[model samples]
Target: MQTHELIKALAADSRRTGVAMNTVWWGAVLVAIVVATTIFFALLGPRPDIAIAAQTVRFLFKFVVTIALAASAFALLRMLSRPETDPRGLLPYLVIAPALILTGVAIELIAAPAETWSSRLIGTNSLVCLTFIPLIGIGPLALLLLALRHGAPSHPALAGAIAGLAAGGIAATFYASHCTDDSPLFVATWYTIAITILALFGALGGRVAARW
Candidate 1:
């Protein structure tokens, strides 16, 4: 092939690849939000007390943590998309949400009665948390996996894990609205378990489906 023709072809291919990646990233975000919102409304809408300012803030706090985690994980997933990219730079961002939550847990422990610690930690909705989080997360996770495939990540499992974190975060945000348990103890325990379960599933799924 002529030199000019070869260069043109490479440029075209690069542009196409860039467009594809953008499509996947934005598409995944839109689909995740729409599907999660639909499920939330169809299944368990916001708690009845959501209108109250204090209750709203309480729920909003959890939403912030989960959504922040999701955003950070999404950023990490984008970084992992390139085969030669290193993920270490993005790791600290991923921990911000959890660290904030841990701080909240410490404060709650200091302020709340020791006698109520177990009850708050256990919460009334542990089983419900386990069920709804993973259930709602499945759609978003699947969408994220589909989107990640376009990037051709080197470590499929890691990419998948991050995608799962994003999905789980989105799902947990929705779940927080329905959850009556507002204590940071409850979030530290049950919410963590639910998100971990989704991450595990994402890891396993990525192992099988995220390969180049």
Candidate 2:
């Protein structure tokens, strides 16, 4: 082949790789969201008093936490999907959601009475939260793992773990609207547990499926 032709072919491959990765990533996210949203509404929905609930700071704050987590995880997963990118630069973002939840927990403890702490942490929907978040997040996690398969992730386990986080965030965002529990204590405890299950699954899935 001619020298110029070889250079052009290489450039074309590079562009195609970038575009293909982006397309699959975005498509995975969209399909995941649709699957999650459909499952959430089919089985559960925004609480009856969501309008009144929306007026409260505590209720509003949980969405902020979930959105932050999802957004940060999505960004990190993108970096992890690319073999050439150093994902460490985005590692700090993973801390943001936890930090926000912790801050909320601190505020709640100081502002609310001590006697209510256990109840808030335990909450009324402990069983429901545990059951549904993982249930909803599973679909998203699978979709994300498929995307990782399409891309070349240097560390499939790590990439899969981040995929879990992203799926959990998306699942939690929808679940929060349905949950009546507004305390940060409940969120920090139950939401974390639910999301952790999905992350663990993602890690396992990655190790099994994302290799090569």
Model 1 per-residue lDDT tens digits across residues 103-141:
889988999999999999998999999999998998999
Worst 10 residues of 2 by lDDT: 6-15
Please identify model 1 stretches exceeding 4 Å from their true place: 1-16, 53-57
What is the alpha-carbon lDDT for the whole of candidate 1? 0.84
Candidate number with greatest lDDT:
2
lDDT of 2 by residue, 1-212 (tens): 97556545644554578887889989999999999999999999999999999999999999999999998999899878765556677769889999999999999999999999999999999999999999999999999999888866667998899999999999999999999999999999999999999999999998876886
TM-scores of the candidates are 0.89, 0.92
lDDT, each prediction: 0.84, 0.91
